[model samples]
Target: MLVEIPIIQKMVLYFGNPSLTFSIILFSILLSSGLGSLISGNKYVKRFTDNSYYYLLFTAITILIIGFSLNKIIEITNDYVMMQKMVIGFLIILPMGILMGIPFPTGISKLKNIYKEEDILPLMWGANGIFSVIGSLLAVALSIKFGFNSTIYIGAMIYLFLLFYIGVFL
Candidate 1:
């Protein structure tokens, strides 16, 4: 989200104000992720087993590809009206949001299987929340120093690290 927020902000700036861009991007990600989570029930996740790692890899690849192409996307839609650009931005983000949603539920499912303790679920969620806040703050600092593109690349690298962790450690 830290990475995505800036990308969306940059894209939406071509058509709208900063506040509107922020609201739309945030709302789109939340709504899409919520839907993705709802769809990723235990049964859906259980079918994957270790194959979930591949999903994470694919998600990371997708993020990198999208991040690389974001400028082109903005250029392609530069002539679009605000409503059109908003819709395009939502469309562009929805897939990444869905992919982002998968890891949490999948990780929880794995943890549940390993620990056999439902209690740990909340701890995982809390840790995730804390890390996300820290990441967002870090992203802001990074963006200030390196610009949004580099910040996004950093986020992509983090995803790559996640893929490596899942591949080697999990």
Candidate 2:
């Protein structure tokens, strides 16, 4: 999903400075997500944690919003300067990336509390890797066939489904 954003931006947004836009997007996502992960452990931030449910929910909703509205966003801001456009893109991606970051650590903490005797961390890590690989491949294929917007919608649906699954099971 992170990997595909630059491609989609380049292909769809047609920013005047494509390279700069790509760099902005990549940097924004990485930095924002890192901040989110870092804050997840903070004492103040912990008070706001709702077992990671809101994080996943926000992430899903944000992705879906982006999927449905990004092109229109670009259109509305088409007259802005290239730097302004890049900044807008970065700001828009920030929340979604940050929300994306919180869930993993929260889940890990939850699992640790629930399964102290068994070492399920390795299994969770493996599952994370496998699903990430599958998701990356699926994102590429879906973006190729249906374009980036639809691919994002599918990703959001997957996130929502995962949220539902976890809500039911764990």
Candidate 3:
């Protein structure tokens, strides 16, 4: 969304165009991630069968869609109406961020389910933060090699692989 912002602005900035394409995309990016948390929580898990089992699965697929369609979205969007499409893309990227957010809280939930302890949640969160930082660094490096499209695809693939690992082992 960041890279797409200026491109979107340059796509012909129309006056009084309430729909800022780049802004919509950025907002959607945030909104999607926040929603992913609730979507990936235990409440939804119990209500929806096999949902909990596909954390990495959803993340992978979502990222891939974002990768392949991003350029298309940019090229096709008109200045004034572009915001709408950008917002719609939120629906696509939401699962990616939301699913990513899931582990932050859900991991605590799962750990508590197994160990029945509250104190461990903090420790788990700290560890989760550290690894997130590390993973982000790796993502940046990968993005340089693959470009945005393949980067998203590869991220999705790796996320799906993590799911496979969890499914197979734990």
Candidate 4:
């Protein structure tokens, strides 16, 4: 996402305002993910919350679909006004962002139960932060060398791998 923003601006929305495009994408992700986080905590969705592997699977598929069809999607929407484009972009990002949000809190909750030690939660959070920083840097390099589509595909693969881990280890 960090890597794809500029690429999207360059390739898909070259004529649009860069700042608006950036903000639309960024805020769409934040808003959708925050909504997802709120949803994941709901008692009504206990069944869904118990099975976060499905969330990861959905996220992987959504990302892969986006990576493959982004060009077509943009081409189809090219004639729309900026506001329409913003909606299109938000819709495109919403599912994956929402799915992405579910896993972290779910994972943390699971870890808390598994490891009763209070310090482990903080350690896990710190590790998550460190990995996020590392992943962002790696994403930049991957996007630079392999292009955004490949980078996105790699991300999808990581989600798939996490699904496997959750199935076996979580």
Candidate 5:
């Protein structure tokens, strides 16, 4: 929600419309994340999951980098055509999309290792869906109230808090 709103807004500013840019952003994220989810079962990804702390740390850092760099990237690409801007947006989001894909399956996989239970995966996904809906609403409200940049900062802070939560509890 946080990241999507700002990126969409920026894309609108660049391209003068929402439909194509939104489709590109949404599809790019979905496709890349689906790829990430599929790759999560790979041996290397499993090895990375073993050190989930560092994985999440890198995720946080990458998100922060994206949040900070997105505006600058838009500025740099200002003269490019709409198609080029779309591609740039996709490339900008692809890494984070892949990283965002990791947590759920990896979390469920880790839990399976410890709990010998199958039901938890569905429960985890359900909880994620609920929070995602709520988070999207909240992100729009925050964006309207505080502006997009602030919303992105708040999103980064939320990720930082998650990092702290993982450090303390996971």
Candidate 6:
């Protein structure tokens, strides 16, 4: 599903080291996940808005831009690796990861306001786990059926569903 991922392949292409490419990718993912967790409790930053519209708007725009740029970013950065790949991945995913994290805290706010108990967190987290597994399964299925290039496009389409649900419905 990573036919559109340049930095990794570029690492492989330039240095021709698969291990380095894999390490670069894992580093990026770990860093982004850490960055995501760091801001997980700060969603109320949008309280300046009268409602959640501003946050939702930002999320939609960010996701849309990221989705569109996924291909072009790969194209443009088709010659980076090692430290270059590390910098590129952080530059790309840092803001996206932060904004994507806002929903978790915002969700906590919503749950607190709507419900009166604490037991729901476990169930909600469990459901999230299931959703993630399903998402991975879908990615594998798409890659199997259409190969990697089309799978990246399919992932973009999947992000649009998130935009529709959270961006519009929120």
Runs off by more than 4 Å, candidate 2: 2-12, 16-18, 43-48, 117-123
Task: Give the 10-residue window scoring lowest on summed lDDT in candidate 6.
Answer: 1-10
What is candidate 6's lDDT per residue for 27-78, written digit by digit as tens? 6655665665565554445452224555556655665566567557766776
Tens digits of per-residue lDDT, candidate 5, 50-154, equal 786778777778778888888899888899987788788889888988988877678777778877955677777788899889888888899889888788778
Candidate 2 on 40-150: residue-level lDDT in tens? Answer: 898866766765566567778888877677778777888988778778878777887787777678779989999999999999999999987877777778777887777
Better of 2 and 5 by TM-score: 5
Better of 3 and 4 by lDDT: 4
**Cα deviation in Å at residue 85, candidate 1?**
0.9
Runs with alpha carbons beyond 4 Å of true place in candidate 1: 42-50
lDDT of each: 0.77, 0.75, 0.56, 0.75, 0.80, 0.58
RMSD of each: 2.2, 2.9, 5.2, 2.5, 1.8, 4.4
* Residue pairs in collision within model 4: none
Tell me each candidate's TM-score. Answer: 0.87, 0.79, 0.68, 0.85, 0.89, 0.66
Question: Which parts of model 4 are misplaced by more than 4 Å?
Answer: 1-15, 167-170
Candidate maximizing lDDT? 5
Q: Name the TM-score of candidate 2.
A: 0.79
Clash totals, every prediction: 0, 0, 2, 0, 0, 0
**Given candidate 5, what's the lDDT at residue 107?**
78
Clash count (model 2, backbone only): 0
Per-residue lDDT tens digits for candidate 1, residues 60-169, read: 78778878888998988899888898898888788888878766676776798888945788788899999988988888788888888888888878878877886789
Q: Among these predicted structures, which one has the highest TM-score?
A: 5
> If the candidates were sorted by their lDDT against the true structure, best first, what order would they fall in?
5, 1, 4, 2, 6, 3
| TM-score of candidate 1 versus the correct structure, residues matched by position | 0.87
* Candidate 2: worst-modelled 10 consecutive residues by lDDT: 2-11
Stretches of candidate 3 exceeding 4 Å from the true structure = 1-26, 39-44, 47-52, 78-89
